[model samples]
Target chain A: MKVVGLYEYLPIEAQESFLDVIVDTPKASGHDLLVRIQAISVNPVDTKLRASKVTVEETPRILGWDAVGIVTEIGDAVELFQVGDAVYYAGDVTRPGSYAEFQLVDEHLVGAKPINLSIEEAAAMPLTLITAWEALFDRIRINPDADAGKKLLIINGSGGVGSIATQLAVWAGLEVITTASRDETITWSKQQGATHVINHRKPLLPQLKALDLEGVEYILCLHNTDAYWDAMQEIILPQGHICSVVELQNPVSMSLIKDKSVTVSYEFMFTRSKYNTDDKVRQHDILTKATQLFEKGFLKTTLNHVLTPINAATIKEAHRMLESGKSIGKLVVKGFEENDEQAN
Target chain B: MKVVGLYEYLPIEAQESFLDVIVDTPKASGHDLLVRIQAISVNPVDTKLRASKVTVEETPRILGWDAVGIVTEIGDAVELFQVGDAVYYAGDVTRPGSYAEFQLVDEHLVGAKPINLSIEEAAAMPLTLITAWEALFDRIRINPDADAGKKLLIINGSGGVGSIATQLAVWAGLEVITTASRDETITWSKQQGATHVINHRKPLLPQLKALDLEGVEYILCLHNTDAYWDAMQEIILPQGHICSVVELQNPVSMSLIKDKSVTVSYEFMFTRSKYNTDDKVRQHDILTKATQLFEKGFLKTTLNHVLTPINAATIKEAHRMLESGKSIGKLVVKGFEENDEQAN
Candidate 1:
């Protein structure tokens, strides 16, 4: 199969950054399903991984996490899926990823694509939706049913993950307070179910006090976790919890949380697949529920920019938009160009 | 009323570290209860608070938290107890503590003392039991129904709080593994309720691995948190949660928990009283339940040593033993010498 893989960690401008190469696409085995790639989404993780210090691999390493695809073959042990099934997943973090014509993914991590949406639309939801879902429900352990009046503040509401998070929290019946700096993004955040929007560039306490809330019960941080650490610490209710998806470059003081008996949790969407955890099948469950919500029109597709005839030119354009730090929901590259569609 | 207050953060040998003073004991108002103090337990938290710098207060501040006494009067809004009720409590962190002949406490924070144990034994329980109960059932959020087969590791077993937490975890049917270094502590920990005892001073992962375990499902850190950051990260199960009560002097890396989606909570027992939270009555409820458990002999007092004729001499002895870090379980101080015979 024709695959996008890298031999070295290089800057995006480098000639050999990501190359089109021919590699053997393996047959489905165990619980794996061989997926014929349809659409793929680029996230910040893809760029960060490309710049990591890990040395060049003996074989070219494919790096893509989010993809919407169709199953062409099914493994003998797979009970959840079969051939000809349309699927969407944020695939395994340790093994090969989803940047290819054909890929192998565990059936437990794959979810059926929403019938109401196209492949590019479905591809954008898996990684960010899964992350936002687990951050609120699992990591922060919000009781959406019993505590409908509880307040949640989603920091960085205009970003890829935050857009989905704000909608999901509102759908679950919690009042949503989100942070957005730009006027357009602030207006967009309100449109996407945020009850109130604050500027992330400023301090949060005075804003919360103005909202007639002394503090919130939970905080979901999507961007610049270390920068918002102390602010979240002070505004979180005593015994409240905070969850963050962004990785911090520096240490976070454990003291900031200890006095109030608060908890801090990290929600990484790839954890289940990375560790091959026992409850890995739950990802499939979550995606199925998310699909139901989407089909019922409770959720809208977060795809904002779509580049067609997925060639090196269009892929590089999507990557640059992401690198610029101003990309709003998601940038998707769909349908491989005929010239680069050579199979292995 | 007679009070024990400290004018400065002085060494134990300073003779004037704790002084006897006379103050006008305020009448009960709002939810406050006026209690005539009898016996008290000295915890490490008390010592730490006494030694802490106090630049804001011009006068000597009363410093104590845990006590068993008789309720003399109740405020207009106090509904939990009546006059002459034998009570035990750990008062609020922000107010004058239980270090005086007559101390005022929120009625919701006090509980009916156990009918079976003596006052000294009851005094030793509140601060530690509250910390233990919240850490296991609330912060770690263990459902007794769901936690039956899970492995739980409690660091620093046989300490003030650990002794009760191990017992409570065992009662919840979790397979309890606790850490203790000394021979006596190991035996005491097993007697208290640990199913397995590992030396905390040694590397914990190899020890856990030797037991045919990759990691534990939960870790309750009752020791120094900064020192055990790496080991706690390594020994925690994928998607596992951890809770700690110790405060770290420096920032600890939050990224250690990022990849696994692990959560870390700080279980400060004083949060409810300090914040006047809506759930303050739960402390009264928990203590009432604890009293029942004690009367039925299902719970055991951690009080291992006692000093009579509560005065500067005996209090200093207790402080020295605590600073030595070799004292086991709890050290309690009884009523003043002249009142001892009248108390009985």
Candidate 2:
């Protein structure tokens, strides 16, 4: 099977960053599903993994996580999915990724794709949806039914995770406050159901004050946590919770929230797959529910940009766009073009 | 009314560290209750506040938080208790504390004392009980019924808060792993219902490994947080919780738990009272439940030392004992001596 992957970690501008190669397609066994990849999306994690410290692999390493695909074969232990089922998932980080014609994924991590949306649209939702869902309902433990009157602040509300988080938090009956600096991003955030929008470039306190909010009960930080750490500390209510998906480069003082009795939770979407936790199947359940919400029109896909032909060139361009830090929402690559074999 | 207090912060050994002063008895209003103090306990907070910055007040500042007393008067809005009702409470930090013969406390912060325990025993419980209870059920937010199979680690398991925390955690059906360096403290920690005891002086990983444990689901830190920060970070399970009452001197990086998706919460028992939150009454409910548990013998007093006569000399002595860091459980000062009036 043909695959687009990397022989070494290198800058996108480097000539040998990604390569075209052929390898034996993996077989399904013991709860694994052999998925024929249909579409995939690029996230910050993809770019980070691609540009990280150099490692020359004996064989090219595949590097896609979010994918929509068809199950061509199922392992003996598989019960959630069957052959010919269309599925979407943020596949396990430890396994070979979805950057190929055929990819293997654990059945527990795959969800039935939303029938109402195209494959590219469905591909954008898995990673961001799982992240936003777990960060809100699992890590922060906000009960959608009981959290009606509370307020949540989504920092960087127009980003991949933030756009979905804004919608989900609002759907959970929370009053949503979001931050977006650009006019286009601000309009997009508002369209995502943000009750109030503020400029993250400016100080947050005055914006909260202007909105007649003293402090938020929940903060979902999708942007730079270090830059907003002190502001988040000052703006979170006593006994409030803060969840962040962004990893910090520098240490943040836990003492900042000591007196307020605050809680800070870190949410990494891949933790379940990485740890093989008892609740790993929760991803399937979350995505299943999200599909229902999407079909009912409660959620709209965050995919704003799409590239055709799944190959090294298009993937590299997607990475370049993401690394620029100006991309809005999700960028996806659709079906492989028949003529792309010439590039290989 | 007679009060044991200070005009300035000083070392316990100083002559003027604490003084016997006479002040007019305060009247109850709003939700306040004027209690005739019978006994009071000195916690680490008292010692820290005493030795902190030098502040000279025109009126002497009283410094006690935990007290067991009789309600002498009730405000118009008081509904939880009546005059002559025996009560126990950790009075608000913003108010004149329980160092005086008569002190005013909000009824919402007071609870009916357990009839089975002595005044000194009851006094030792309120502050520590509130701290431990909130750390487990509120901050860590462990559901007692659902968390039966999980493990909890309590650092400094024989101190004022840990002594009770170990019991409560065990009662909640969580396996309790606690830390104590000294043999006496280890024995006490076991008596407090810890299933496993590890010496905090050594690296905790070996101790945990020796017990056939890989990680704890919950960690309640009552000792120095800075000292245990790294170990707690290393020994916490994926998506686990860590709660600390100790204020850190230096900043600890929040990045340590990023990949594990761990939650770190700060538990200041007085947060509700200090902020006057709408949920301020939760403390009342917690203490009321604690009283029932105490009466049923599921929980026991942590009062290991009791000094007779509530006076400046005995108060200073209690402070000295706590500051020494060798004291086990809690220390209390009993009712005022009749002839000690001459000392004033």
True contacts kept of each: 0.84, 0.75
Best by lDDT: 2
Q: Model 1 over residues B216-294: C-alpha lDDT tens digits? A: 9999998898888889999998889999998666666666689889988999998988888999898999899888888
- Residue B89 in candidate 1, Cα distance off native in Å: 0.8
* Candidate 1's DockQ: 0.72
In candidate 1, how many clashes are counted? Answer: 0
- lDDT at residue A135 of model 1 (Cα atoms): 92
Q: Considering only N, C-alpha and C atoms within 3 Å, which residue pairs clash in candidate 2? A: none
Candidate 2: residue B120 Cα off by (Å): 1.2
Q: What is the C-alpha lDDT of each candidate?
A: 0.85, 0.90
Candidate 1, A143-189: lDDT as tens digits: 77776978999998877888998889989899999998898889878
Among incorrect, acceptable, medium and high, the docking class of model 2 is medium
Task: Give DockQ for candidates 1 onward, in order.
Answer: 0.72, 0.67
Determine the iRMS, in angstroms, of model 2: 2.0
Docking class of 1: medium
Model 1 global lDDT (CA atoms, 0 to 1): 0.85
Chain A of candidate 2 scores what in TM-score? 0.97
